[model samples]
Target: MRTLRRSRSRPWPLGEPTSPDGQISTVDLLLVRAALHAGATPGQAVTALHDRGGVLDTTARRIAAGEDLPALALDPACPGGPLVRALAVAEVAGAAAGPVLDGLVDGVVRAAELDRLVRTRSAQARLVARMLTTLPVVGAVGIAVFDTGARTFLTGPGGLVLVVVAGLLVVVASWWMRHLVASVGRAVRDVDPLVVAMRRIGRPAPGSVGVPPTPGEGLPTVEALELLAVSLAAGMPLVEAMGLVARLGPPAVRGQLRRAADGLRAGLPPFEAFPEGLAEAADVIDISRRWGAPAVASLRLLADDLGRRAAAASEAAAEQLSVRLVFPTTLLLVPAFGLLVVVPLVVSAFSGFRLGP
Candidate 1:
């Protein structure tokens, strides 16, 4: 068995194997695929990364010339590392590499969509934050240096201190808010996860709508689904597919699926055999497969859902930021506005009244 497994993983026969914060541009992947289909070597494909004759293109050339393409595909830094890993596994299992690549392309498209949502939303938040930041400075300058009635009052020692303190607080608050928003954005993004959803793993589901929160949490589901899809495509039974993933998928979620596969083979209820979440997922996949839904297509849908979930997480983080901004904004802007705009008007009114008397 070990010898057979080793032989199967023996690097892909092809010469080569192998983010924005979330937009999906197929131009690069498409370019690579086109090159490969046209019989270009891995090195050749990478070198053809088009007008981008810089470090990236150079890196691709060097890797193709020097490193083992199959081995490098598993590296996190590799472009489409996860997809390459999937293709490698599919090749080993005797599945059609072309079909697997198609599945991978679908997954990448979904991931890109998720990235786009996160990036755009964060940018909007950043723009809003930036606009607010300039408020105190503009207001301060207007009152302190421009308004004649307020010139004397603002230039006084007491007024200068108020202006200075307000300016400092506003600056600090704006900086802190920007940092907080960025931190929140980073928090939502997770590195590639291992476990994937089952129903969605093998069967290509339809395009999903609306991204959900915490894409990382759903990745185990995506991993599981992708494994099942590949195994099923290769003609493995449901239990067999589950067992295969338990062995090959990320260690974090593997054991549970392994136990479930074992129990399932022994005639236990499918739902009772696996871990809670995985079991539910596995059960759904089992039912759907039996219902005649193509495993790959269904799994594709699952993958899309997971992508949406990631977008949702980013959105949630962005919403939380707006709430967080409230405290600092009130502390800085309100006081600055009142001190700059309201105070002068009140004082000027009183001064006019006294003169009339």
Candidate 2:
């Protein structure tokens, strides 16, 4: 067996060899199928399969030699099933190239991971999202300042001095602005009410309507329903209540609520009028109808849960922001401010002392 293994270890005539153990798992075959379906050459598919620890040398040779590989190798229950689906979709979309499909698959995986992580600790996710959103703007401003300073310095003696001062000013301003933006973004993303509401309403469910809230958007389900409930309790009609909620909620949620409200105005019952995307939250609507409870009541409970989550997220974000702020303020801003204010004075004092000497 060891001699056979060593012989198999020798590079095969056609391509890489497979293991002798016949241990080629279903996931390995699915990956090969996905790769081939995505337009990979058999050689490339084999390489990828090998990279993923799917198959080995002697076994690959046997399969290449037209030996019967297990029929179970392509089972949909394999871990690579989703990858195959994505590959098939890419092929149908005319985007079956390795890099493109790979990126697509990667993005899907990332989104799933992010969703899990965000659901687990929504506040941190919001904070991170906010920071990512603001990064480009902050970087642009830095580049602009650097360009301006370089231009100024190229001009002459006065220009050089001005360049230095302006460059320093821009740097200081950029640092301060970055710190402020980060803090504000963190605060906004971590808003207690919004986070809580999102957690309540954005949970994975069968009939849930709409995507989750963006970083800066106010909490959706909570804020919308709260507004609607208040309107309803104040003697407003359901259509009017919905209009009010749409006007008050985040743009995306507002659009959905507006549609729901329009359906209601067209004579749809309250339970029937709930948005399509919120199929996951059907139980809430069901409870509302079966118990003869106000439709807004069930939604309100969801909102309240979200609001509490948002609050916790906000507090955590605020604490993180405070800690982050300390570094730039003391190390960067304070020193730069001291230079801007005290440097000239010190320079003048030294000049006066030299003249007297």
Candidate 3:
């Protein structure tokens, strides 16, 4: 396995670390993935990763000493982090190391991209917020200094009400705009890559039908599909492939898949036996069967498509945020500043004069 060069001053990579804690880096995980692809067992992979040592050394030593890496991953106190967790999930599915590790790499890359998108959007929103806040302060200061009637207005009942209303508007508009931007971030966070992949699956081939995906079941559809593709690539029969994926998959989806598997056992065709909402998946499998094309290749293409779409969507949301900001500025902030700041200064400037006299 290739090890990254470590300097005495900075043992880690120069760029942003994957985790908030500086201990484990994405580079380390990529190295592990490479080792796994090259036929190293999980334990062996970690042990080799240890020599490039930092925070990983302790965890690697344990695995090297005959500890089960996947089991260690399940223990929260263990040093094994997300990489181990991904490995554990793959191990449970009895998936080939290749596809599992490949998926892990892709997942980490996608997550990093999403984080950057979110951070950029948040920074832009904060900048706008700062500028909006500055408006009221600057207006108030200028009015106080330049307008002699400011005192008269400041002492009046109407002026007091205007000031109070303006304050409330500024505060409320700021809060509302912040909430809107935060909600977008939360939505982006809640978007599961697996679910995204499944949603982007091409429509069922013409003249074919499959059951709609189980409502509220929220099963891991892409994981199931990827596992199925892996099995098929390994030359397993379709029935056995479905059975294996169903058996080792997550408990939530196990029963759903088992029902499908049972249907297959009873000699039902792929379109019927595959779980609900898997019509496109069935079609892909059927195509693979006919032309000897690799279903996993199609899966890889789908994953790439999902990443592109997600990135594009997030970018659009950020751009739309800038446009939406105009609403609160015009309706709340601008009116409040005019009432509380401009009106007082203008009225106060003529307070000493009596026109009817």
- Name the best candidate (by lDDT): 3
The lDDT for every candidate, in the order shown, is 0.54, 0.43, 0.58
TM-score of each: 0.58, 0.33, 0.61
Clashes of each: 34, 29, 3
Candidate 3 regions exceeding 4 Å error are 1-24, 34-40, 43-82, 93-99, 106-126, 141-157, 183-279, 289-294
User: lDDT tens string, model 3, 39-131?
Assistant: 887667777777676656777888878777656653433453434544544554455665566665566566556657755765666577668
lDDT of 1 by residue, 1-357 (tens): 000000011111111110222222356556656775786655455556645552235346546576544455434334433444454455445665555545555655655454466556556556667767777667767765666666666677866776777777776776667666655444433322322332224342222211221222225455666766787778877777777666554334554567777887997766677666554465666687579775566665665565466556666775666676777678777786677666765665565565433
For model 2, give the 10-residue run with minimal summed lDDT.
Answer: 1-10
> Model 1 compared with the native: what TM-score?
0.58
Show model 1 residue runs off by greater than 4 Å. Answer: 1-25, 36-59, 107-127, 148-157, 168-220, 235-279, 285-297, 308-332, 340-357
Candidate 2 local lDDT, 121-231, one digit each (tens): 434433443453344335434433655442333354744464466456546645553544344334533443333444556553332234544432234454345445445
**Error at 252, model 2, angstroms:** 9.2
